[model samples]
Target: MSATTLPIPTDAGDLPGLLWLPEDRDEPVPGLVVLQEIFGLSEYVQQRCADLAALGCAVLAPQLFARLDPPVAGIEDGDDVEAWLAEGMELTSRLPWERAEADAIAALGALRAHGAVDQERVGLLGFCYGGGLAVAAAASAEEEDRPPSALISYYGSALPTLLERAARVEVPSLHHFGTADAFIPSQTVEEIREAVTAGGTREQVRFELHEGAGHAFDNPHPALHHAAASEAAWRLTAGFLAETLFPRS
Candidate 1:
C-alpha cells in the first residue's frame, strides 16, 4: 500500500508523518506508530510501514527529522559505509533526545486517534535509533495511563541508557537484537534483555537474538543487511504483531 502525508498534532506543532492503511479496510483496524532510524524515514523505513499496512494495520511513521532546521525527510544510503554512518549519527545528535521522545509519543496519540484505527489496539514499532525511542515512548505513555497495546524494537541503539525506565513499560513487547552488533555489544544486549524482560520473569516480553547479524541487519544496504537474519526477524515480528496486536479469533 502507498503512504500518504499525515500531519500529527503535538505540543510544539503538527509534525509531518506518513500514513498507510490496508486496502481492504472495512472497519477500524489496529494501528501502529513506526518510529524512524537515525537515517530518518528513508525508503527502507517507508517500505516497512507499507509491509505493516499490508498486514492489516493502520501504520503511521512520523518524520522526526522534520523538526530539524533543514528538515530532512530521509537520507540516502551511499557506498561509503563509514561516512554514511557518521552522517546519520551527526543528524541524530543534532536533534535533542527529549524532543524526539515527545514527538514519538505524540505520533502514537495521533495514530490512536486516527479515524481508521481502533484506539485500544494501537501499538508502537521502531528500528535502530527509533527502537530505543519506542521503549522510552512506551514508558512515558504508560505513565500517562495511555499505554500502547504492544511494543517492538529492532536494535535500539539508545537502549543502554533507557534501561532505568524499562519497568514502567509493562505492555506486551518484542525486542530484536543482533548477537554480533558492533553498535550495541552482545553484553549490552544481554543487559537490555534482562531489564526489559524483568530478568526473564515477564512472560509477555519476547526477546530474540539473531546470530551472525550486525547492527542494522535489516537495512537493505550491502554493508548492513543480513538476509537470513532479516528474514528470520521479520517472520518473528510478523508473528508477534499478529498475536499481540491483530489476532484473529
Candidate 2:
C-alpha cells in the first residue's frame, strides 16, 4: 500500500512523516515509528514501512533529514559506493544527534496519538542510523514514562556511544548486528549485547549476530545487501513484532 504524508508535531516544528496503514483497518492497531538510515527515508525504507503495514501495523517514518538546510527527504544511491556513503554520513553529521533524538521521540508521540494506532501497543523500529536513534528514543521515552511496547534495531551505527542509557530501556527489545560489520566490530557488538542484556540479566532482551554479514546488510545496495542475512533478520523481526505487538488471541 502507498503511504500518505503525515505531519509530526515536534518542539521545533512539524516534521514531515510518511505513514502507512493496513488495508483492513477496522479498529485501532499496533503502531510503529520507523527511523531512517543515514540515507534518509529512501525507497528501501519506504518499502519496509509498507511491509510492516501489510502485517497489520500503523507505521510512521519521520523525515529526520528534513532539518537540513535544503531539507533532503531521501537520497539515491550512486555507482560510487564510497561517495554515496560519504554523502549520507555528511548529511547525518549536519543534523545534530540531539535534534534527531528529539525528533524520533516526537515521532513516537505522534504515532501514539494517531487515530488508527493503539497507543499502548506502539513500538519503535529503525535501521542503521535510525537503529541507534531508536535505542536513544526508547530510553528517553521510558524516562518520561512513555515507553514503547517493543523495539527492534538493525545494526545501530551509533550504539557504541549510547550504551550508557541502556539501563533505562527495559521494554521488549531485539537487536540485530553483523559479525563482519566493519563499522561496528564484533567486540563492540558483544559489549552492546552485554549492556543491553545487563550481563544476561534481562530476559526481555534478544540479540542476534548475523554471521558474515556486514553493516546495513538489509539494504538492497549491491555493496551492502546480504540476501541470507537479510531474509533471516526480517523473519526474526516479523516474529518479534508479532509476539510483542500483535500477539495471537
Candidate 3:
C-alpha cells in the first residue's frame, strides 16, 4: 500500500496525480485510471483506489481540479455537499470540457507508460462526473486503437451530454446507476441503455440498476450511502474487472 504523488504529462500541462501500487509487487499488473467525482479526489476515491490495488492493480488518479488557480484536490466528509457541489461546478465551469477530456486520455497514457503496469491491460473507472469523462476518454482511445481494456462508470452525471460519444464506447463496459437518482432520472438511464446497446451486443455492455438507491450511493457518507446497494455494486465491479481485464489464462 504505497501511495505517492506523481506528475502526469498531458497536452494541457503537467497534471499532479496520485499513484497507488500494491505491495509485494513482483510482476507487472493490470492498471486503472480512476477519474474523480465532482468533489475531486476525496478520501472515498483514495479508498476506492486502494481497494483496486488490493485486487492486484496499479491505479493512477489525475487531479483534474489542479487547473484551478488554487487547486482543489478533495473535500472532507464533514464539508457541506451543496457547497462543495457549487464550488466543483464553478471549478469545472472554468475548465474546458475538451481539456478535461485530453487530461483523462493522458491519464491512460501515464498508466500505460508506467513500468509496473501491463500496458495492454489498463482500464478506466470513473464515478459521477468522471464517469462521463471516462466515456469520452474511452471513445477517443478506441478511435485511436488504444482503448481501455474495460470501463466501469457509476452514475455518470454527464452521460447525457456525452451520449453521442458514449454510444460509440466499444470496450467491455459496465454501468451502475440508482433507479432513484435525482440528478439522472430513471428515464434518462433507459435512454442511455438504449443508445449504448443499440448495436445489439448487449453482452458486451451491461447496466445494473439498484431499485431505490440514489446517486453516489456507494459513498461512505451516511447521507449519500446505501449499504446494500454499495456492497452489491462493489461485488459486481470486482467481478467485471477481473473477467474483462484478467480473464483466466
Q: Per model, state how many residue pairs clash.
A: 0, 0, 0
What lDDT tens digits, residue by residue, belong to model 2 across residues 119-168? 98999999999999999999999999999999999999999998999656
- lDDT by residue (72-142, candidate 1, tens digit) is 99899989988998999999999999999999999998988889999999999999999999999999999
Q: Cα lDDT of all candidates, in order?
A: 0.93, 0.94, 0.89
Q: Give the per-residue Cα lDDT of candidate 3 at 149.
A: 95
Question: What is the per-residue lDDT of model 3 for residues 1-249, given as tens digits with 9 covering 90 to 100?
Answer: 667988999876799999999786777899999999887899999999999999989999999988887878886675677776687677778778888889999999998999999998999999998998999999999999999999999998899877799988878999999988998988889888887776556679989998889999998888789998999999999999889887487
TM-scores for all candidates: the values are 0.98, 0.99, 0.96
State the local distance difference test value for candidate 2.
0.94
N/CA/C clash count, model 2: 0
Query: Model 1: runs farther than 4 Å from truth?
Result: none
Q: How large is the C-alpha RMSD of every model relative to the true structure?
A: 0.8, 0.7, 1.4
Model 2 off-target regions past 4 Å? none
Ten contiguous residues minimizing lDDT sum, candidate 2 = 160-169
- The order by descending TM-score is 2, 1, 3
- How would you order the candidates by lDDT, starting with the best? 2, 1, 3
Clashing pairs in 1: none
